[model samples]
Target: MESEVSRKVDFSIIRYAQCWEDPEILLEVLDIKEGDVCMSIASAGENTFAMLVKNPGKIIGIDLNPVQLRLVELKKAAFLALEYEEMLEFLGFSESRRRKEYYGKLKDYLLGETEKYWNENMALIEAGVINTGRFDNFFQIFRKKVLSLIHSQKRVAELLEKKNKEERYEFYNKKWNNLRWKILFRIFFSKFIVGKLGRDPRLFDYADNTSLSAVMSEKAKYAFTELDVSENPYIEYILTGKYTKNLPFAMRKENFQKIKSNLNRLELHNVSIEKYLETSEETIDKFNLSDIFEYISSEKYKELLEKIYEFSSNGAVLAYWNMMVPRSRPEELGNKIISLSETAKNLHAIDKTFFYSGFVVERIVK
Candidate 1:
């Protein structure tokens, strides 16, 4: 049976244009070995493709939303058909005026449905597919509407400037954290506003009761002061409209050819994780269950974990994020799954995506 959140939230459109979870942290925790089969939730298909760079034998990308699966197919076609620079340009990393022309070139590589979808939505292709998601639009609004009210272009640029720990902290405290910034940020990021505009309200059903805006504001502070803004792509995309200094793992130039070479290993399925696990014959060595627990009930979370454990091989790793609702290996499964809490904590400290409150990693020992 589908969960209430799943039944309520609209899935016909893309929720995330880019996977907000940090692939760096995911790769670190999963530690994929050569020839290992992996499974990942296909949100925008970024992290799933990122894993291909590690030379995994195969990667199965499962998503309940068919539109998201189309995105994965579209991205796969882009990697197969376009060169590195062209891929970046077509995917909205670099500026390009010929995205429609590029789409023409990629048509031969896409599946029938994917091709039809892109053909129908040529405007999204022309506007750059990476910036077309609802989440990306939310960031665009924050960048253009809310951010402009708080800081000028010069101040925003200064915020992104390379700085040491002491300098960054001082800058944030003295110049960046003004009263206007705080008030406007809270107003824009409040649960009600975010639910209506940024994300589906059902996503927050299991979210913490504390002020969502306040928690997010503190997370932003950590990203601003503690992390290196110059290399953080999430912050860069949120502040500016596009990536400049660093790109996500799948989009990096060095990994492009490698991912392209291993494109044969990628597979996409439009099905729930539970459904996929029930039918999957392969023993998965790593699972990138991207923050899906945040939307489901606690009972369903535990039930899904057990299903995953049944399909996992010995020493298989499971990594997921907690945006609001805290979830991890249940006590009943403690003997079967070993918690790697210390490793998760260390990785969470350096996680590039700062919005998530926790990153949990566990291993099947049996």
Candidate 2:
């Protein structure tokens, strides 16, 4: 028999350094207000910073992975210790040969653990923290090796310049969409590979068995052929390994001062959402769970939803993504957990990153 330690999954390492969700849709659905305390899962901490723009009283970002929370702390430290442009360089959003020196400057701002963590993993920091994680590394490989083979840099830039939707669709059909694109994409981004590298393997247990390649192909076609890829920062970042004009609010230069001013209001916790909720006495005004439900089990999801309901105040909004897995509140809890499926659907339609099968929004009734 396997030892308990060997059998248990360890999630303390870095999972994602960049968020894949569309913060625009989330902010629109949440409509966060002043004096509201928000709870969010700190997957790369992108949405956490996005949520801060609304001037919420507090935003607590909790993650099962300590390394992920460390990244969040490093981001906060960047704002505290560096200027707008310097912050970009320090976070690995831009090229800089002095990143190690910058890290040294910001070391005082980080917690003892966060500073020590960075010191130990200096190689990741030197390479650029935003580009070193499993998910980011996978995307980098996909972009450089897979995407570069099919579409030349000039061709992709030209496609983004196309304004007319009909013209873009025609261009994609004629110049881009083909059997080769589909086949290679499927082989590289398959569920087996994604689970092993991009996400936890158990997350795929409840994920749809249907061809992920097909699902991804459709999403890719929609993003590239139908939607304006220029405005979709997630796609742009995945393709180029960095953001230009379009970026998450956290990384944008204009928002840097605002984030720095409000950095004190944000808190980072290295704990599972369920564990945090069970121990905390705070009445959460909003919850951003991300796609964590897909990673756990149906029963676990139900149990956590119940805990969320218990901890929520009136008008508390909850948001999460349903990737390949389909998860919903049990009918027994329907009276308490009111479905905002229609609202979620509207947001999903306009989501910049159309990777997930569904985006779920719900409210706990008073």
Q: Model 2 clash pairs?
A: none
Q: Model 1 over residues 197-268: C-alpha lDDT tens digits?
A: 888988888877889899899999999999998889989889999888889888988898999999999888
- Highest TM-score scorer: 1
TM-score of 1: 0.98
Clash count, candidate 2: 0
Candidate 1 has an lDDT of 0.90
Stretches off by above 4 angstroms in model 2 are 1-8
**lDDT (C-alpha) at residue 238 in model 2:** 83
- Per residue, candidate 2 scores C-alpha lDDT tens digits across 1-366 of 111212235667777888888888889888898989999989888789988888999998987677788888888888889888888887888888989999888867877888889889988888888888888888988888898888888876776664678887888898877776767888888888887767666667767668787788888888876788778777877877787757776688777777778878998887777677778999999888888777666777787888888889988999988879888788999889899999999888878887888899999997
Q: How high is each candidate's TM-score?
A: 0.98, 0.95
